[model samples]
Target: MTKTLFTGVLSLLIASCSQQDDRICEAVAKAPNTISECVHREGYLLADAEGSIRDVATAVVEKCRNHIIQQLLSKPENGPSLEVYATAIEDNAVEEAIRRVTEARSGNCKKPE
Candidate 1:
């Protein structure tokens, strides 16, 4: 019984230390800024046009539209600002990711600025 418990603990420790193939990480790695770029990457390949768009439980948009509305909301808005969206990646790395992603997302967000 002791041996079994020890093995289980060791397994848990190993799993905890292992690097996770996180989607956000992969997405950032593949394309730091834009959604289109990330979609072409391995994990994000599944992110291609999905369901329609919904507005706070309102009408829906065209079929197979980009379902990641959160991405759009990230644009620099003069309206109510929010800082709730953040990731755990290092600042430099995250900056790189944002640079890449934003480049691709160009013009799709808040008017060119």
Candidate 2:
């Protein structure tokens, strides 16, 4: 993406940080599996809009989801199922944070599929 487009996107995301955090957090807290919670959170994350921006965001989302799942899976004793809800909250927080950071960084909007 051009620097201007990247800047515009990042600016858009930075401007909207606080608004989406709560919803994302809630979704993350209740998710079951990494992919499941990710899928759920992703829906919440992309609650609006269409087109390549959404497509690019989806791509990054997989990475984000895996990152969360890995974190949750690391503690097998707790088991992903047992602690999924609480982890979802954290996952949401982390995801939102990632969105903000990515927006600011605004890497190439790689298509998810």
Question: Which predicted model would earn the best TM-score?
Answer: 2
TM values, all candidates: 0.22, 0.28
- RMSD, candidate 1, Å: 17.1
Per residue, candidate 2 scores C-alpha lDDT tens digits across 2-82 of 999999999998777534343223424354355444544454445443445445355546545665556655665745574
lDDT of 1 by residue, 1-113 (tens): 99999999999977754543333233234332443333223122222124221121111111112423445455456643344332211232333333433332321221111
Residue 33's lDDT in candidate 2: 54
Residue pairs with backbone overlap in model 2: 28-88, 29-85, 29-88, 29-89
Error of 1 at 104 (Å): 22
